[model samples]
Target: MKRSVLKFGGSSVADFPKIKDISLYLKERIEKGEQLIVVVSAMGKTTDNLLASVHDLTDNPNDKDLAMLLTTGEQQTISFLSLVLNDIGVRAKPLTGYQAGIETIGKHLKSKISSIKGDLLENLFEEHDLLIVAGFQGFNKEGELTTLGRGGSDTTAVAIASAMQCPCEIYTDVTGVYSTDPRIFPEAKRWDQISFEEMMEMSALGAGVLETRSVELANNHNIPIYLGKTLSDEKGTWIVPNDQILERKAVTGVALDKEMAHITITYPSHDRQFLSDLFKLLEDAEINVDMISQIQNQDGQQFSFTFKESDEKELIRLFNALKETYPDLYFKIETTYCKVSVIGAGMRDMTGVASKIFKTLLDADITFYQVTTSEISVSYVVDEANGEKATRLLCQTFNL
Candidate 1:
């Protein structure tokens, strides 16, 4: 029998009433003879609340214990969802990451799916109409629970879909993927179809519609992802191969990333080996460095880099460690910046995209601290307050 995976975000399964509504949606699909696997996130703000509670108790908690505490949120959703479905006369079974056989490998709080033992899931399909799996968590080889950090649930849904060789449907609060965030630009247009590469770029550039890791996983496994609202019948966006998109635009979307921190470090020497060693430390720490700039003078060299705000503490810890090695190293941190980017697969074959982006920002009199470009996208760092304005102007300039 063919199988399909449907993933509901936190907002969709927020309360009992919402869970009952999702059961109805699943019941309709079961009536149509669709074998289903439902992956769900924690209830609305449940994970955040859990983290807050933990922090209130202690400033520093053990990573393994923290992951153990966090996994309970998704586990709660799985149980509640399964109970709701059974109440509606639909046969549903609930499984945690371990029970479902999602094996992972990495650090405690942020692990990646190493592989899945899918025989258990295949067997469950015989007796149940729907299998409810908790998202965002799995057990590592040491038999310890681990979470996937941000977008962990989305990664779980896509990973299961890939293993099952089925299409994945992600149900969120939005109707579909928009050219830009609708809240930032009310006139932003929603896309009916988007190429995986385009979506990947947008996701990586800070589009919140889908997680970047999920898109990368889907693309790697050649799976198509359907994104839509949980309860609405409105049409959503299809993320597929680039070849499947007939008409490609020069600029498909604008994305804004507000959670960023900029750091600049000045060293006493201009030696190349010093810079390499500093970056090697960051690499070993798994810090994702972006938008890097280097300036050198007769006195010393200064390096600037941007990274996710959430990683600021880790970065600072590494900086302190490095300071012990280079006693004269001076560093400054700025948390008031955001990155706005324009993405389009068509940019690979188009010209003047960078110029257009710069001209647009210049015409708007927006001051940018740094600029970076990939083959298919151009990114600029501006003050957090101007993020929306930059995104809107880029969207209109490209007619996205």
Candidate 2:
């Protein structure tokens, strides 16, 4: 029998009616002789609401207990989805991540998949036409529950598809991947297919359609992913190998990340060891820093980097501690920054892409604080207020 994995986001299966609609959709597919595995996220705002509840109880919650609390959301989703499916006369079995043999290893709330016991799924296939597994939460070797951070459900779906060697279909509210956020620029165009590399860049740079780790897994395992609207049969975007993409645009998309903050640290010492130790401190704290720039001045050397706004409070606390320890280090934090990026696979073969981006932003009267580039992407840091305008102008200039 043909096998496929279908993943539904929270918005897709938000309520009982939506779940019933999904059940009927799956029933038609199952009747066509296809054995399926279904993955689902917590219903609309369930995870967020749970997190809010946790915060309401305490200013700081234990990671282990937090993970334990969060997994219940997905559990609720899987059980509810199974109930709706069974009510509609579709034989469905619901499994938690642990029950489905998903083994992960890492700290609570940000674990990585270590391995999956495919044999367990294979055995269940004989008895159940559809296996509904909760997404985002998994078990570690220590037998602790762990959540896969934000967009973890996408990672779960791709990991399962990779393990089972089946095509993965991700159903979300959006019809497909767009050149820019359609909400920001309603004229944004969707792609029929996107290269895995380009799509990964977009996801990492804030195109929230797919998770970055999920794209990496799919790319590594040669798993083709179909992304589209949950209930519509519209032609969506296919993320596949670069060879599968027939046409490559110079600029495939524009991605905007509004939750970014910029930090600059200046120290009186010019020693490289000081810089190295500072980075080690951030690493020990599990703070991810991006788009780093270094400058040497008459007073000392300065380092600037960008990180998620969610980490701002922790980062500030760390910097304060560092100041007390170093006694000679000065730091400044800018929380009103956003990252705007242009991504495309054809960037490697193109010329003057960075210049074009700079010219467009300049013409829009937008000033950038920092600029960074990779083989397939160019990113700029600008004031959060100017992010949308910069993105729209760049989209128009590049015709993305």
Candidate 3:
């Protein structure tokens, strides 16, 4: 069977009309001999509205109850889409994450998918060519409903594709992957294909097209991902292995992330153990940190790192409590920072990439708060005000 896993974002299934359009599109695909496993997110602003209702009820809602309530969003999507598909004479089965055997283990709000029983999916596929599964949710060992955190829908789609060993096609609002966000670079060209490693770096560094974990899952499972606009004729972008990439540019893309906070923590002593203890707390709190730089200050050791700006409130609470133990510890967080990164597999053999980036920022009189590099990417944290300008300049210079 020419089978594939397909995912539609919240916008793609926003209402009955959109869902109907998707059904028509799927009918054509099925007629062309493609069997599909479809995944869908909540309708437009559904998750947000649901969250708002909960927040109105209580400022600090229990994560377990929140997970149970929030998952209803995806459940509604799956129910609606399946009804439309079935009404259109296409055999469809709507399955929740639990019904589909997506067992996850972790905290209630941001659980990690631990295993999926492929037999359940296989059984459904035998009766219906279209199996609609709710994204971003699953069940834990105790049979409690759990939700995956941000970008969880993307993770759900890719994980299923990996389990089935099939290509995954993600339909969204955009046409394809661009050299940079088109809002930032109107002239940015869309790539026909991108390497998995490059895509992963771009996603992590800044591009919001695909989540890092999803791309990483696709890469490890050797599952190709095609990103395209929903119900469009455009072929979109293909993410695959490095050797499968037809062209390798010096710098394929530049991404700008505005939702990052920079933190500088200074301790009173050269205590590496302090660093360990601090990071342990961060890990336990499930904070995703990046671009860490450890430096030696005149008095002691200083560490600078960047994390999601959304985590600022939680981090403040964490640091405030830590201060009780170490009265002299100094920690300052600046939320108005943007992380800009240039990503390309070609950079593996390329030099002067960093120099070019630094010179571009210098000529623009933009100061980089921090800098980090890898085999194929370079990231810089700059004032949020200069982020778009710096990204545009680098995009132009790199011909991205």
Q: Which candidate number has the best TM-score? A: 1
In the range 344-400, model 2's lDDT, one tens digit per residue, is: 989899888889998898888899878889999999999999999999999999987
Error of 1 at 357 (Å): 1.5
What clash count goes with each model? 0, 0, 0
lDDT of 3 by residue, 89-146 (tens): 9999999999999999988987999988887798877789899999999999999999
Q: Could you tell me which residue pairs clash in candidate 2?
A: none
Q: What pairs collide in candidate 1?
A: none
Sliding window of 10 residues with minimal summed lDDT for model 1: 268-277
Q: What overall lDDT, based on C-alpha atoms, would model 3 receive against the true structure?
A: 0.91
Predicted structure with the largest lDDT when compared to the true one: 1
Candidate 1 local lDDT, 294-356, one digit each (tens): 888988998999999999998888889988978899999999999999999889898989999
Error of 2 at 47 (Å): 0.9
> Candidate 3: deviation at residue 78, Å?
0.5
